[model samples]
Target: MLFENQRVTPSVSGAGEFMKAALEGAEAIVLAQSSMEELVKVHKICRRRPGMKLLLHLDSMKGLSKTPEAVSFLAGYIKPDALITSSPQAAVEARRHGITSVLRCFAFDEESIDSSLKLIERANPDYVQVVPGVIPVTIRLMRAKTGLPVLAGGLVRTDADVCRAEKAGATGITSSCPDLWQAAYVSRAKRS
Candidate 1:
C-alpha cells in the first residue's frame, strides 16, 4: 500500500507488530504523534527503517490537538513526509513548512464527503484517508467524483476487505492485517 496509518502504541508488544508486520511492504506510514515524547519515539523507530516514509499525524486521540506546540515540536525532531489532521488551519500551516498535508475527514458522510471534495479541490492535498464504515455508500460515490487517490481505512481485517475497497474506487487499503498482505503475496506467487 502507498500509505498506512499507525497509531503509536505505548505497549512494546504492539510496536513490535507494527515494525515487523505493517512496515514490510508499505511505501509510507503515518504515526500518531499523541505527545511530544511519543512523537520522538515513533520518529526514532520509523527513521531507523530504510525505504519507509513517515508522516506525523496530529490526532486528538490523546488530547494533542489543543496544543499548538505539537507541530513545531515535532518539526524540530524530524521532517515528516506529511501531517494528518481534521483541522483546516493546521493543514494550511503544515504546507508552509514544505511538508505534504493530508486532511483526514475520519468518516464518510454527506457533509464530510462534500467537505472532503471541497478540501481536496482547495488545498490539493497529497492524498486523503476516509473510513468507509462511516458511510459505505459515500465511498463508492466519492470514488467516482474525485481523481485523487483514495485510501480505505478503519477496521479493515480481511483480504475481501482490501479487494472490496479497491473495487469501490480506492487505490488500495491501509490495514494492520499481515494476512491480507500475505494473501497478496501468495496470489502473486500463484500467478508466477
Candidate 2:
C-alpha cells in the first residue's frame, strides 16, 4: 500500500542532479548505476536524510564482490531499507538479514520469461521488478504467478506507460526520466 501511493522511486544514475532529484522526489530512492567507490558516500548522505527510505541496486554497482557475502556485507554496513538485485541468492541473503528484497527480472524472450518465472517462485522476493516496464501482459502474468507486488521499471518514457503499468496490476512504477516525476505524472499515476 505504501508503494501504491509512492510510485516514483527516482533511480539515481550519477552524482549531481540525478542524485539530487532522487532525494528531492518521493519518499524512497534507489541508488542505481553507481560505482563501488560511491557506495559509502551515497549511504552516508542518504542515512542523514530524515524519513527517507533508501534502496540500493546491487547489480548495477561496479567493483563489488558479486556474491551473497557482498549482500550480507552491504546489509550490515550500509543498512539500506531494501536492495534491488538480479541475483536470487542475493535476494535470499537480504531476506535472511531482515531487509526487503526486490528481485529484478528481464523478459526479453521465452527463455528469459521461463527463467524469470522459475526464479520468482524460488526467490519469493518482497517485490518483483520487470525491466523495460512496457509489457502489461507480462506484468499481469508475473503478478499471477508470483502473487507479489510488482514494480515496473526501465524504458518508462511517458505518463501513459505509468498508467498502463498501474492498470496492468503493477503495484508501482520506477523510472529514471525526471519528467515523469512532475506533479502531472504523479497525479496521473495516482488517479489511474
Q: Which candidate tops lDDT?
A: 2
For model 1, what is the C-alpha lDDT against the true structure?
0.55
Q: Once model 2 is optimally superposed onto the true structure by TM-score, how far is the C-alpha of residue 160 displaced, in angstroms?
A: 1.2
User: Model 1, poorest ten-residue lDDT window?
Assistant: 4-13
Off by more than 4 A, model 2: 183-192
Best by TM-score: 2
What is the number of backbone collisions in each predicted candidate, taken in the order shown? 0, 0
Error of 2 at 184 (Å): 4.5
Native-vs-model 2 lDDT?
0.79
Query: Candidate 1 clash total?
Result: 0
Q: Any runs in candidate 1 off by more than 4 Å, and if so which?
A: 1-14, 33-35, 60-63, 66-69, 133-136, 181-192
Please give, for residues 1-192, the per-residue lDDT of candidate 1 as tens digits.
234232211111234444654444444555553555555665677778765566666664354562336556546667777777666666666776666776666554578678777876666666566764234455677667766666666677755665566567665455544564443422323211
TM-score of each: 0.71, 0.89
**What tens-digit string does per-residue lDDT give for candidate 2 at 62-180?**
87654799988987888878889888998998899988999999976778989998998788899999997899998998888788998899998887898898889998888888887
Deviation in angstroms for 1 in model 1?
10
